[model samples]
Target chain A: MKFTYQINGAEHTLTLEKHPEGYRAHLGTAIYDVKLLHAKDGQLHFQLDETRHTAHLAHETPAKRWLHNAGRTLVIEKAATHRRGADTAGGSGRLTAPMPGQVRAVLVAVGNEVTAGQPLLLMEAMKMEIRIAAPHAGCITALHATEGGSVNKDDLLIEVEEIPT
Target chain B: MPQFDRVLIANRGEIAVRLIRACRELGLSPVAVYSEPDADALHVRLADGAVCLGPAAARESYLDMNKVIDAARQTGAQAIHPGYGFLSENAEFARRIINAGLVFIGPPPEAIEAMGDKAAARTRMQSSGVPVVPGAQDLADDTKIQQAAATIGYPLLIKAAAGGGGKGMRIVHSAADLLEGAAAARREALHAFGDDRLILEKYLTDARHIEIQILADQHGQTLHLFERECSVQRRHQKVIEEAPSPLVDESLRAKMGAAAVAAAKTVGYTNAGTVEFIVDPVTRDFYFLEMNTRLQVEHPITEAISGLDLVHWQFRIAAGEALPFQQADLTPRGHAIECRLYAEDPANGFLPATGTLLKFSTPPGPGIRVDSGVESGSVISPHYDPLLAKIIVHAADRTAALQRMQTTLQDTLALGLTTNLDFLQAILAHPVFVAGEATTHFIDQHLPNWQPAPDIPAAAIIAAALAELHSPSATTHTTASPSQDPHSPWLRLTGFRMGGGE
Candidate 1:
């Protein structure tokens, strides 16, 4: 059987074949003998060639995998056709939440004039407060985040249409 | 003084768990207060009794003084331990706790008031014959600020009078930036700390953040438990802390230790507190930075080296006990280092990450201590501090301790969210850190463009592929088969997959 995996934005194909002792897998161009040492409770303890590795799968979300070995973690996910980027990338002049957090305060309102680098809102996450600033001098056209509202990463918070001097 | 048979911990997270363990060790009952979101928290589960304060917001729960006091009263707890943040440094909270006939396991309210304000603490330190950074008292007006700036010269700092953790702090390189810097500092201070007052100090560019851990009792006995160098920081928040700074010699340690004791004595400080200092690496001269009037997040290293239980001492002191050991009797035996594991994404400017901790495994061994309130299935809420745990390792020397820390960090696994664990490993392996040449500007000087781990092992990739194939949705697909036929040439694999969802 041939399997495809996406890791850190790169994809590779693994071809698995049955063996008398164990299983042989050809990952990309390299071939290795794979041994399943232990597997239970979302944990995978396996051996590839001479090296051993442990991978944990989330109980609820099985498509995501946390692979641990050699003092490093590789988070792999099933490749999706569409990728999510910062929502403000299309020259919309909109500010988006940099990470998941709660809006501590919405300092600016719709139609409020703001200067470049002026703080427009305060967001709190992980017990730290981050100030959201205007990317450029503009008037606020829309505000999507309210005080105490929870926001996710890449969620649009405010739209600022730059004013031509 | 009353006997503290049961202590109410008016805090949450790792520190609360730490206090609960200490209370249990000392044969005292621990009463934990939790917010609505933390009803199933590890600390609540570990405590002898638990009380629901309010919602997830700190203002409505942990910081709510009345509710905390009422919980203590209802639980019949004789003492209250305000761990680290939250209401730890609030003087009014101490006053209320003491007035309500409960022992506050911290410094006196007078001491808290004097040291709580950074500007006032500097004044007190200077008056007590401690060397402070060249600066002026609180600058109330523009003229006063300008005058102070002239004396202090350019390359000065505008700091919030009642601030810590880098909040309301600004640097001015020239006269042109002084007013704006001071204004912004005042505004931020007002918003973050509720005090708009500002202070000016001659900023030292190349300095090391060295702090002394001091324990005082009611009988005027104060002693230093040695020093911890916490120069490795980002945005003025410490991430890596260790005991016995590489720069401090016996003479310098004695000098700084005496100064820390004097500062504590001047403020009538009691219980466990830290006196922070900024030491110039070249001149070896030290100046008083400020005094933290409560348990610090990095206190574990001090405990690891000195073999002392700081929380136990706080409880003993608050219960009207004297210092058990004199200054000369205590000495650090080994070296210890602590890495703060935070739920943050190093690839994304260290932004906080929130989620249900789908997988959390702690490395266990001798000389390794993990103080954590989080576990498998724990929730990493944005409503509180991102600190998930403190991974502390003690060894015979710095070299061994560093090696142990690297290994322990590798074994420490946390999934389902972004974390600073790998970033911490990178720091531990950095050449500068290995050479013990790190200063206050260490992180900025090195690893400024810290990216996430670059390479993925082939084994990991293969395992991820297998897990994906074994997933429920993938099993239902047309091509992939979930189960294996042993008699045939196919071998089946069973493992759980991590689903990246909210």
Candidate 2:
């Protein structure tokens, strides 16, 4: 089916395909290996695996595109896609690293106003200094890291409440 | 030689797996050693047999000399090959292995001890007319030290007697910073190498870190396997090493090779080892940096260029074999580059980070060889080097190899932990690195600070966005919307899914 679409502020026609497994989408001339997990109201969450990583793409029906590849072909319908259980995530404690690095300077003052991308702390992982930007605009209700700290994969940095801006 | 049929590797991670490959190719029975953390490591599965070495702490396992020797003895092994770092260069350990009547598979104890002492090696090289660096006499008083530095030149280096890595090294431009720099060097030296004694030398900026690999036998025949450029470093530790350096031409290669041979012969060097040199780019002149009497991390580039296996050569030479490939017959054919894929965040100051491999996948194509120590499910704990793999690319020229590396880096992906992926991408993208204008200060001179590219690749954004939601252990986001849209949310959600509030 052809649908009038606007992504990244560009108007285009997208071809949506229904397959034996999931929906195949060809949007903006690029093939999207898109997988839908849970669709509630106007929100549709999907996963995208291009080459190496399988990305869970949160695709809102009335979506916003941050970028559009110039002179690039999109074949979302032709891209290989798969569906994984949305409930597959069976655990808790969702603290993610602000960025990849060794925790050098974690300025977690317990509770603080951490706007989305707020500079929560600093880390030196690959001989470079990078400020740990807050994942979302939130009130940091809990601080997980300390100054002069060492954190491993998925180790907590800080806990923030996702209060609407 | 005390002989055994099988040898158990007393380490986990990459070097252990590398050793297992060497052992299997050499027709020796291989045994895997694991910590509680590495029972699922790639090395354990690859080995013919596996034994739990001990807990995850290296000091209790890999660095535990007694435990290592005991594992070797218990597994009925003839020798222990300390593959570089963790106890590979330790002289005391080598001596103990010798006293235990087990082959060390490296240079003699005397060579390790001699090179271990930077003072003695400098003295020996100087005596042998190896064109030693001009430095102060050992440990002069404050005034005498100033006088010595003044005599040497305005910009002189106060290098630690036990220095190998960039630690314990101080560059004094004038007499003003002499005392403080000296004290700092001494403290770092004492901490790193147990020896606070330092010698002075001229500090040459814009130098290339090139080194020649030498294989000397007990029969007095020593040959060079060409050189590798390793100037790309962070915190004095070499992060990337490449062979047939883009800087050195044929004539320069010969001169550097000869000097390396001379340095090795001066100390009666043998086995698979590297003689490091700090080479001036403009003058094409070089100086002896130090000797690493063990396998280098980037030996694959050497192996690719020379078409000779240094590790196999090591075993053969240790097993009373002569240098199989003559120096005259060996010549580098192509330009090769190796980027060490460390488990650190380059956005940060390259501090080491540890994590379990969630989704480890490499770029698949030609002209690329990945020397990986861990796999998709391996755990990279804080107990060892954060280097997960060495992504090596070979091509007809340096440009092709570099392009291949950039493509490979873009294509590769790892979930669950952060890495220096973007940092490496930035370095390779630099005009200087592309122009083959690499130096010891390449990182400093070019990228003193990290900046996020305004235009990140479409693939990366998509991957990051997709990763935010799809990654195995990620929290399910209700919507990928403007309010909670863009890929960074998936990144943010990675935290929320785990319920990591406290």
Candidate 3:
């Protein structure tokens, strides 16, 4: 079986084949003889070559997994075989909630022209206030966040159309 | 016997757990109160009794003084311990608890009120012969604010009069930004603390935040527990704390400790309290910042060095005990460092993260203490503070303590959500931090753009791949057994079987 995983925007492919003694894993040009020592409840104890490592893997979604080992955690996602093109409608002008929080105020209205880095909204999360700003000089085309409304991570807060230089 | 046999802990999170343990050690029945979402919180499970306050919104539940008092009454609790935050520092809440014939395991209402307001505290400290930062307060209008700003000069701070934890603070570099900065600070202050009053202070560049812990009994004896250095801060929120500040010598320690005791005495404070100060690292001169009438979040480091359980003392003092020792008898033996473990993304503006803590583990060994409120399978809700735990380490010296803390952080693990663990390690490894020369601007000046190392280890990738292959969902494409096969080297992992495993 061939598996492709993405970490920090980079993709790596791993191929695994059944072996009589254990399993053979091919990661790039390096081949690894892997032996599973113990596996239970998201905790995996395995040996790759001469090193023994313990890692915990938890699945957040079908394609996303959190892998932790030796005090480090990495967000690993199964890379989609079919890649999508860039979002042309909003591009860099789309503003989203950085984290789950409540919109404290909306500083800009639809159709308002904003300079780069202009404050557009205020959000409250974990008892701290954060200011959301415009990414570039643009005109607000849509406003999705309302005052005192709750928003999830990556939820669209605003959309802006870029102003030509 | 103590004055109260049953005590209600009127808070949640790690502090509540810490108080519960202390109550048990003192042979008192600890009762816990929780909001709707915190029904299964670790504190509730560990307490002898628990009551549901209300919904998840803090205002409706934890912060609702009426609900908390009523819960204590119904639970048959004779005393209430507001373990920091929530209603811990609220003077009205303390008075209400007393009026209800329950012992409030903190200072008197008069003390809380006097020191709760930062501006008022500054005035009182100045009158008590304590050095105060040059600033002005109670500026009701733009004209008064402008006058104060002119006197304080450029690079001043606009802070909320009723603020802590840096919620309503703004720094203005020059005259041009004064009015705008004050307006923004006022709005934030009103929203966060329900008070729009602002105070102006001259910004102290590269100053260290040192605080003295003072304990007082109802019998009028007050003694200081020395000092804790909390210089590693981000936006005024402390990220790391240590005891016996590297900068303070015996003479400075005695001076700051005496000033802290005098500050508490001026307020007639009782139980455990901390007096914060802003100290110039070069001259060793310190100015009174504010007095926390309740226990502080970083009290564990002080406890580590002083060999005193502050919570135990709070209970004893509330029970009408007298001081058993003199100030000279209490001495710090070693160095202790504490790092706050928060469920926030350090690489992403330190924004809080919420999810189920699928895997939670702590380092276990001598001189290592982990005060936490969550366990595996616990949910990190968005309705409360994001502090998950506090990891503290103690050793014979500062260098040994720092090294132990570094290893302890490396040994601890939390998965299934973003955390500041790696960022904490980075801070521990920084040259300035290791040298113990960090000030309040440590995070900003040293690691303003810190990001976790981009490279992922190959072993992690291989483990994830193996786990994926062993998952029950992958059984469709391969003939791997769903159960652990004795003859096979690969053990089939169970739990969280995706896609309706057969």
Of 1 and 2, the candidate ahead on lDDT is 1
TM-score of chain A of each: 0.45, 0.38, 0.49
Off by over 4 Å in 1: A81-165, B468-502
What number of backbone clashes does candidate 1 have, counting pairs of residues 3 or more apart or in separate chains?
Answer: 6
| Model 3 per-residue lDDT at B464 | 76
Q: In each prediction, how many residue pairs overlap at the backbone (N, C-alpha, C within less than 3 A)?
A: 6, 49, 0
Cα lDDT tens digits for candidate 1, A44-91:
677888887776655323235565656676666544322123343534
Shift of residue B427 alpha carbon in model 2, Å? 1.5
Please compute the TM-score of chain B alone for each predicted structure, in the order given. 0.92, 0.89, 0.92
Candidate 3, A47-153: lDDT as tens digits? 98888998876666535777778778788887753312325534587778888997765655443567899877877788666778888887665667766689998
**TM-scores of the candidates in the order shown:** 0.82, 0.72, 0.81
2 versus 3: better DockQ goes to: 3
* After superposition, candidate 3 runs with Cα above 4 Å error: A17-21, A81-165, B138-143, B183-196, B472-502
Q: Per-residue lDDT of B1-502 in model 1, one digit per residue for the tens?
A: 3487999999989999999999999999999999999999999999999999999888999999999999999999989999999999999999998899888999999999998788888888887899999999777799999999999987999989988778999999999988988889989999998899999999999899999999999898999999999999987889999998888888999999999999999988899999999999999999999999999999999999899999989998988899878999988878999999999987778899998776788778999999999997798899999999999999999999999999999988787788999999999999999988898898889988898755667777666555543333211111222223354221111122111111
